[model samples]
Target: MKTMTELMESNIKKNYVFSFLMNFRLSNGLWMIYMASRGMSLTQIGFLEGIFHVTSLMMEVPTGSVADLFGRKLSRSIGRCLSLVSILVLIGATSFFHFTIFMVLAALSYNLESGSGEALVYDSLKYLKAENNFISVLGRQEAIFQVSSVVALLIGGFLGTYSYHYAFWASSGIIAFSVVYSLSFTEPPILESVGRNSKTFRGFLKQIVDSFSLIARDRKVAFLIFFVQTILAFSACIFFYIQNYWKGLGRTEFQIGIYLAAGSFLAGLVAMKVQRLSHLLKEKKVLIILPLISVASMWGVALCSNKLPFFMVVAMIEAMLFVAGNDYINKLIPSRSRATIISFASMMYSLVMIIFFPIFGRIADTISFGVAFVSLAVMASCLYVLSMYLLKKIG
Candidate 1:
């Protein structure tokens, strides 16, 4: 048997590689600019994003189930390959229709990774009887990759200064490497694999159905799922508009890069401590308190004109949302359908994004980014009340 040290060492190595590979997204930092450069307007961009999230929502469960049935390693490899191809297409894409196709494929790639990656890491930890470390490990890996993406974000911007193709080509090469690495990852033996047969298909459907039933029936899990979706949607709207929000306030074009880079660093720095925070505060408190941070952050964004308050609040709230939500939800599901359950969570956020993106985009265009920012804060505040009430009653 592998000793605990050996198991941990191996797992950490694999996890590190997995973490960096998962963040191999170069186009992320500049997608808005790239599409804008292609002559797409704000409405068109929002519509394309809506389409991407809708596609991701549709695919999340099936792909998560695919990972559970086949292997997360394979699922992850497929995601990276798809992302690589999507970036390649994006590089060659010159028209609105081409960009729409790119969004479809990119969204598919995101769904493939969303749940499978988390499930893979959690299961790997569980197999080694190191479940207690899952939160810590997850937090650390997110921290690492968030920092890596920070670097990629900067590089992507620099490349975009020359040509958007430079950014896309660089992104594609990174994703190709990630695909190779994911293909090499060994699946944990604890996962039950499905084979080609009607019987296996029936069993797969049953498992998915059971997972859905459990989430629906369990009030707390259901609340957590939806709460995460809403909070993330709030973040998504605020985040996507922050660059312009700052520019509207008379900040330099140079400061925008700093804000983006700072946000990533602060996100990583805060996320690294999520495990410790979760252990210290417990889930109930986390559920109750995280939203207060979101509320405060949103208010800060709406009210504060200075850079530090805005950026710091944005960073902290985002870090808290991701880490706390995952810490709670990961412990609530069975490993047999863990990926699918998480995908359901991902789907919630996608659904929220699909519904809200255009509305917020229009609001930002018609009224002001500040008004839209405050509006999302109010929505988040309402969600917070619901979260506290539900958790208080059942938790």
Candidate 2:
């Protein structure tokens, strides 16, 4: 029989392995290009992405609730299975309806892990009495994600030059490893001890109410969730759409891959330093700096002739905030409601994406990428000002 220390170590290490496998999504960087190749307009692609966020918005919380009430291991295993299925569907999809199905499946896969995985890792660390290390651990996870992204984008871009199907096929194979790793995870005692009664449907609803009620009452947690997710939504909008924009500029698959891979590499480096940076800058300064970075990057992408520098900066900012913000919010949430509340935070990202993605896509289709970027800059700046105001009021 394994000791508690052994079990806790197993859970944490296994989660890293599972995360590495799941995020090694070879088709991620080129999926937009693949859809465009299928004779879908950028506007059509935008709507498809909108469908994804809508599904995520609906499913994120429920799936997270299941993870909290049931087991993170089971939730993760199911999500990996769904991810494999989604990739298979993407491989054969031709029509918009087929793509819609793929998007929904993909979104559900994302929703399942969006909060469950974080909660699992955190609670596992908590079991080890290493909860204070969560931010540093989160940084390592982000670094792992970028490492996977670097390899996937390089190979997927190469495969995409020949056939997008090949890239997606490789993605499916990678997700199978995720499934196997997820099943090997030992559930943290934290959830079972605190969440035993929250397994029923009524219990689930109560969990939701209590979680949101906590958020509603906690200004700092609410601010962290909204501020982080809102900026993240903006960053994601740029990253995906930039794939199309770069293609429109006549960049080859290999070159586009290099561009994205470079950003991922830089982000990975930044992610590893998130804890150090946070400590150095202090919390308030870090918060102020991140929004300014977002605002400047957007405008740079819009106005400057060279956008790659700005693009790469956005990637680093994203990695930094994701690690730091998750640590902050998770510190505030109780164990029983942790997954659900974090999922609610994730749902905010989906909500913002659903609203902004289609609008930006329409603008890009009708106007120009420059104008679309400018629009994002303006929106980000306004949000920053409002966020600062709110922060000041809370202070």
Candidate closest to the true structure, highest TM-score: 2
Angstrom error of the Cα, residue 12, model 1: value is 3.6
Whole-model lDDT for model 2 versus the true structure? 0.89
Q: Give the RMSD in angstroms, all C-alphas superposed, for model 1.
A: 2.5
- After superposition, the stretches of candidate 2 with alpha carbons farther than 4 Å from their true spots are 191-196
RMSD of each: 2.5, 1.2
Q: Give the per-residue lDDT of model 1 (tens digit) for 1-395.
A: 77655654575678787787667566766777667667877678778889999998899888888888777888888888888888888888888899888999999988988888888778877777777787788778878877887877777766766776787788888888887777655676554444355138786787678779989888878888888778877887777777656655764434555567678888888888887777898877777777787777788777776645665666666776787788678888878788889999999999999988877777887888768777877777787887788778885
lDDT of 2 at 337: 82
Predicted model with the maximum lDDT: 2
- Candidate 1 — which residues are off by over 4 angstroms? 1-9, 191-199, 246-255
For all candidates, what are the clash counts? 0, 0
In the range 1-395, model 2's lDDT, one tens digit per residue, is 99988998887777666667877999888889989899899899999999999999998889988888887778878988999999999999999999999999999989888888898889989888899999988898899889889989999999989988888988888888778778887888773455556677888888788888999999999999999999999999999999999999999887899999999999999998989988999888888998788789888988998899999999999999999899889988888888899999999999999999999999999999989999999999999999999888887
